[model samples]
Target: MTSPLTRNEQNSKSRAQTFGIRPDLFQAAQDHMVKKSDLDELSENLANAGVRGFTAATLPQNIHLGSPDSGTADYAILPFTDRYGPAVAAHPEPPSLQIEESGLWTVTLNLGTAGHGLAPAGSGFFEVSIYVGPEQPAGGPVRQYDFFNWRVELDHQQSFATTFTVDFVVESPGDFIYVQVSGMRGRAIEGDYTRTRLSVRKTDNRTR
Candidate 1:
């Protein structure tokens, strides 16, 4: 079956006639917006059209960043899976993307409160970077994964959570892609994380 994005692109004019310009343009009028599931499906369709497919790994836990010495925050790799848990029965290793064919992949990182804990002191500016290399960096020169510039800064009092997503293109197989997160605050407002995940969805060259 043709993908919705493909269908939408092909039938833009028809959609415009009914949507008043484009489906996206009507979002505000209709009080709606593009959902993650919609993008996920589109990304999946793009991946299946050329590459093997897409995959996502997540760690359901509360972690901290920019704590103790907030001035010089340390970056932490977002966990993909629980090393010790029932999930290990299904996911033996950390959730990872093993690119079979180099192509663009969408990566999303979401962070939220798990329980009552510290929120940022005032406002928080967090920078999350995606990286790929022979080995995980250890305070050394490392290859920065050049994807969309995905960064999020928010006033802690304004919101309790944030999500950063971007499309990244890879050209080879066996390359490891991961996320590192750091915050501007000296110490992260400590709290339980309600949502924390690193998702990757591959797309076809048509996305170019």
Candidate 2:
């Protein structure tokens, strides 16, 4: 039997034919890669926004805003598509008021863990102040021009989970819109407090 060629020789012979090389094909490949990279970058940016975006499920405590204290930027909730009429999941929510604000639409809020000692059945209760303010243009101070806020009590029944949903619809339009979902709990499992926050964004009107 003939002896097998050495690995080095085999590699050299293989290297002699870099067959997949055509100027047009190479250019097309590069263009495709570039397009794909751009798309990837765009997708990542949106994901980052949602991951860190403000809503009702994320709002924290004390942060207040607006005239007459109409709506509070407390906590932000996701899957907003499931909010409003015909919820996919039967939302066992507390008594919610039909909210109406002005100037800004598409409100956003954020929530976070505040202290230790988790709340019972995640059903602690307290009064919260919600707001939706306008974003400062490019470089400016935090302004509440055309903003509104209000106070309401929020009850949680989502035990063994981080947070729950409390979505709303903007009955009007304006700027710097955000949401806040906060209140006092009867002390969670000694150091397990939930903190929430709010921020706002604009989107095409598709009420859920």
Candidate 3:
């Protein structure tokens, strides 16, 4: 005859039976079981590793243009009235998207123009520039990065549109990105805010 099992042994045997495993195996399984704390930590890490980005756009009624003769002598930043993203703001001179984390980023600029008025009688062109740099103090100068241009023949007035893209690395936070547009001499370039947009997105973990 065998002696009856102790209360703890009986309870262990009952749990093992429920799992269809031997008591020794069930006891070892406890070591590999996932704990609640471990799951919570994983959730937090995933949230921190998510992607970040920003977009700033304008409307047709609020688009800004220089004098007809303003020409290509210089570039003017596009006044973006609407913005979407966590790091975008309306201040700090030349309003821009402020970088909150360091990483490789892709910047895109889209521009469109309608032929509302008479352009020069000959050929003319429009230029688009993308600027990226650290936040500047009030009245500080702007720095330029990527530059693109679209040539249009003034033989007949028509519509124009183009997109520019660039990839660069941000090594530190607090950087800013903006867009500017210009036209050839003797012609004033105007934008259709309905088709104009600027965006910046973090694409990688690189910071080089």
Candidate 4:
């Protein structure tokens, strides 16, 4: 007959066998034990390495379109009025973002089309474009970096929404980024300001 374990022995045994069946659980527990200060330091280090800047802007009001110009198929720039973060500054009408740092950035554009008479008469394509170039010669021509075409079929009372994301290398500190939209087949594209957004984030430390 063996004697039973004492209270101290039983407690020690329980502690030792706490993670007996799952070693992964034990490892997870160890990982969760990291101090908050350690995490703060890690975040600070990442920021210092140029991997933590993000900037976003939103349209201030819904875009209103006039009669569609059937003679042209050019893209019109969207205006961004509100800004968030310190990495970029939002320009006035014909909105553009002024880059304050030179690095590899991931740019994302979100658009929400309102149900109106500006859409195509039938199923057609809507085009969105992103341009990046110098800010000095305001209104000057810019290089198109990325573009997306979305097929939308809607009546005067239907809405459409889409998102576009692209990675771009910005080598000029004072460069400006612009977003444009156009409608095909002699139509126009308009968006709800509340749902339209443009965001930019640094993905790497390469500043050239």
RMSD of each: 17.7, 16.0, 5.1, 9.7
Q: Say which candidate scores most in lDDT.
A: 4
**Which candidate do you rate higher for lDDT, 1 or 2?**
1
lDDT assessment of candidate 1: 0.53
TM-scores for every predicted model? 0.53, 0.24, 0.64, 0.60
lDDT of 2 at 148: 40
Q: Rank the candidates by lDDT, best first.
A: 4, 3, 1, 2
Candidate 4 TM-score, true structure as reference = 0.60
Instruction: For model 2, state the Cα shift of residue 21 in Å.
Output: 40
Q: What is the C-alpha lDDT of each candidate?
A: 0.53, 0.34, 0.58, 0.62
Candidate 1 RMSD computed on C-alpha atoms after optimal superposition onto the true structure: 17.7
Model 1 lowest lDDT segment of ten = 83-92
lDDT of 4: 0.62
Q: Which ranges of candidate 4 are over 4 A from the true structure?
A: 1-51, 66-74, 85-94, 118-120, 136-158, 184-194
Q: Give lDDT: candidate 2, residue 97.
A: 17
Instruction: Summarize candidate 2's per-residue lDDT along 16-132 as a digit string, tens digits.
Output: 453544545556666666586788999997765432222222211332212232322223221112123222112212111112232123443333333223333343443223333
CA error at residue 136 for candidate 1, angstroms: 3.2
